[model samples]
Target: MRFTDLISYQALLEPSKPAIVAGGKIVTFGMLEHAVRSLSGRIHALGLQPGSLVGLSIEVPSRHVALSLALARCGLVSVPYASAATLSQLPPLALGLSDGGLVVGSAAINLVVTDEWFAPSEQPVPDVAIADDADCRVFMSSGTTGTPKPIFQSFGGMDAQAQVVANHHLLAGRVSRILCAMPLKSAWGYRSTIAALANGIAVYFAAGTADIPMTLAAYGCEYLICSVYQLQELVRLQSETMIPLPSLAAVCTGGSLVPAELVRSAQSLLCSRIILIYGSSEVGHSALEVAGMHPWQDGATGFVTPWTEMEAIAEDGRVLPRGETGELRVRSFAQARFGGQPAPDGELPWFYPGDRGSISPDGRLTISGRTVDILNIGGTKLSSERIEHALKRHPMVIDAGVMGVADRQGLTEVRAAVTVRGAVAEAELRSFVATSFPVAAPQMIKIVAAIPRGDTGKILREELRALLN
Candidate 1:
């Protein structure tokens, strides 16, 4: 079902229910639907084309959901942008989104074709959402070099994915409150904004990653669907019992493998179980831990929804046995993408988004790692995640980062940097790492107060590379 349909459903069935709570204000489903419909009229009144882009710059709350819904309702494409990217990055982000079309909003940057997008209501509309044969909904993803990739999305691709979320994750008759912590400019972030709304769950918006833990505590957020790094930080901060989480039910960690210790700790500390989900900006939220057992431990590691058809394929393009590990190729025509890319895989009905994972013997699923995050030591292939997971386990370490650095001789070295909770010398960490990975002892180590993180909580690899260099 399309995301817009849920608004109508909630408006009729539970119209007075809280649809959004932000900045000490609560908007009910009926009120939210009216706001969306009215805002959609305002958006359309801008004389934008049927599939042209309409930007939403709401910073405090309701930015993503309202904009996504209104644009979907009006048949105008909506492109959301995070206001926090570097100034040098904004201009390119705007130009990339505009694609020769008019731009809008003050949140991303100042308006106009050549400059950055504007903040919400802070700048004039950059471009009219005019008629466009081209795809709507431009999403920016982080490049390997730490640049943003402009991926287009069609309205159809979005709806198809929302159905999967509505069926697989959202339980019926259960009072759920979805916290929007991830920025909406990302496909995953935008989808999370609307996914709960698509299922008629009350939505709570956290200004950014900074506000998540406190905001989630304040709202008694039942379900948190956001990046794993943010969740990890939240779990870390919530290690103490003073933080109130009376209403929190499920901790949904995406963007990477949910740390098992984090899950167990959150369950003990905040009284909420971690629900681990594996997904991407391109594929939407896919395999979730199976329900039951501990709140954090899904009996199965793989997603079990009927809406999506998934296969694990090997390097040679052959489908792997269910018990083996491979790339996760999936298809869902019922869901919509940001661009008009034609149902992902077209005739084949599958999309392999460069993730490496496996389906277990018991039909459970586990995401081993991402294919894009490989590290080369000389010629040996090492999963960066494996090293990261190992490093985070150290008690004195708050965070750890590993990058492939080459020696003067040209042999690649597994270099590490760590943020510590207590005093830790480089040699001490090196000693620990040597004990752990005897074969691949890191030759270099740096003690940083905190690993530099991009807006998405990913360490800035380019910045780290600069550090190593």
Candidate 2:
């Protein structure tokens, strides 16, 4: 079923139930359905085909959410761009992803949806049939390299993945209110929002990271979905004043490497269950760990979900035994595809998630690092995540990023950049690293106000290297 249908079902069951809260405005399920249907009727008047691709560039979360549901109801593939992207970046991104159609706020590129389109008329919400194989949504990859690649999710895949997320998180009926602090364009935000709405849960969109605690307190939200960096900032803020969010039961964090220290601190300050999720756009949640229920290790990402299959493979493409570190490959029941490629030949096809990790004999997964972020220094391979984890152990360091840069002699040398809470001597940090990891210690350490990161909180290795140069 389409995502809009989920909203419609909720509206049918509880029309007066709060559906979305954004920009200090609350929209009930009934109001949401009416707006979606009205907007969808306008879209259908544009003569766009069922399977046509459309780009969404709306800035307001409420409007963005409404238009997204309208597109789904119209059976059109929606490619939502990050509202914060520059004007110059939007054209290329829309052109590359959308099929000659773009919707920016209330305006349309190839078609117009004016006041007349939404005027009183009996247009019966245009009966459009969507095939299961048709592309339902296209999510842009968070890679820092060339043009962002589009990851397509079929309608069936979207529903299945949403179900898996809802079931795994115990979101259905159990969660009444949730707060989303991530960008709407992100896969995590899109999928999580759908799961919440499908489960008839009310969602509140925080204005920014600073507003999250207030939003949660104001809405009395029971759950929060945020990135690791946001969680860290919240923990830091909690240390100052305990933001009253007594209803908050769980805080789900992912989209980057989550420090064990951050999890422990958040649990103490927030007084909520902290869940660490490990997954990517290509594959829905593969593993997760709950703070109090699961044993929190330095790099452990929890155990693989029952609906997913995971394996670690060596460079030679041979599957490694448990306890051996290698690249992780996962296959889920959701059957996610990279772009348009089908799963490889097997009873269940495996999709390599580009992360290096290992599974223990008891089925716990430990994420070692990213395959692309591995650093080669003096012929010794080192995981950047390992080095960053070590740096964060320092009392003064709040954040750290490590990368490999070339030296004057043309040899690769490990370089580290950090964001510290207070003044920290370079020699002191170097001595701390040298004592713990002498062989893989960074050759140079630079203290900056903040480390560079992409939208998903992954460290931009190239950007970090540029800072060193």
Candidate 3:
């Protein structure tokens, strides 16, 4: 049931198979296994034992992955920060190590190690066996609305997700290599990488959208995964260069609302089809839509995946019938525990992703908006999603977000930020929204270069609000 066991099995079966491709280098399974063991020994020398929480801030995708496996090999818990900046915001780690050799500690211990810290060591590190229920990884929330919460995943949960992904059949045997267009620290990126490795598929970590063409041309990749933002960038790049990735079979995207136009563009230019996934870090792979096979629905995210059970529950805890819009609750075998509290046996708790959506009789899910995204304007509770939708209806507006700002008089003011494909006047956008809801028209509309989003494509409302302020 160990995560490393999967790699070990792959190494034994196909030692020379390429596992990771990054920065013009290919790392085989044999090399990956050796690096994991070497890094595990280094971690052990740092006085970190099994179950100890280690802060990982590696920038290199290969090293980040290697360190993650090393931590799992030693049965230590890993808390990966998206960047070093994020690492500094949290409670300072007791000790830290990087390629730069900067070592800092709280009270006494501080030692600097050079690039030798990354050198492989044959020294055997004690294998601290991990229990199935023990927490092995903690994922930080995207912090779109507030402070990021720690979402904990047990060893069993991780293994279950890998198996679920392996059996999902979307990339089963069709995908030999995948290009990751998102940061490895993100839940989506990490899950995709692990699933690919678990299936013995090679992963290419593209530096950015600029590197996508080169990577695809040099090394053929069948699958691509990224957030909506990265997908947009890729499409933009392709449109400008007029280069098509004929080797790419499918592109899977998540993290924000996928516009029908973007999906169509991606299908025509980037790949043959687009797979839009709908889920949160708490509930993995709740639903997905294969765009090539299905017609696009205005607000539909997709059909529920095989391994997920979803329901729309009213505020009173009543489960609504299908086709009724309410708060979405998802129950998946691969669901993670928040705040480190496991649900009681025989009563697996349903995960509330804060999305207000409905399930059709045929199992299609359409999300109207998020419960937290509702705005209290004057005396009425207005759906910001509705306003954003109105703005996006304009031919020039590509994306929009609305937020309520409170003044000293306890009055709420509606403000909007929008990204446009062409020049769009704020008055025109405001007038367009006024045509929909004249009374709840936005007080102010500002055109921006881009919408603030996390790696997964979720809007960073906190940052958006900051910009509005």
Highest TM-score: which candidate?
2
lDDT of each: 0.62, 0.76, 0.76
* TM-scores, all models, native as reference: 0.79, 0.89, 0.87
- Per-residue error for 266 in candidate 2, Å, reads 0.9
Better of 1 and 3 by lDDT: 3
Predict model 3's lDDT versus the native: 0.76
Clashes per model (N, Cα, C within 3 A): 37, 0, 2
1-469, model 3: which lDDT tens digit per residue? Answer: 5656886788788989999999988899888877877888887777764676666656677777888888887787777755544455545454354434333333123334344655778667767767888877778778888767777788889888877655543642388888888677666678778877877888898877778877887798888887876787677678779765778887888765677777888877877677877877777788887875666676678899878899998999899999998988888878887632245888578787888889999999988777887777766766786787677768787677788888778788889999888777778878889997886788888888888877666678989998798
C-alpha lDDT of residue 452 in model 1: 70
| lDDT per residue (tens digit) for residues 379-409 in model 1 | 7676666676667777888887778776788
> lDDT tens digits, residues 1-469, model 2?
6666887899999999998898898888887788788878877877776767677656566666777788877887777754434223432322212222354442245343343433455666877777776777777777653345667788888888878778755821377998888777888888888888887988889877788888989888988888887888788778888888788888989866777778889888885588878887877888887866765666788788888889999989899999999998888767655743255665656777678889999889987777877777667777887788788889899889888776889877888999998998988888888786777788889989789877767676777778887
User: What TM-score number comes out for model 2?
Assistant: 0.89
Give residue 184's error in model 2 in angstroms.
1.5
The Cα error of candidate 3 at residue 139, in Å, is 0.6
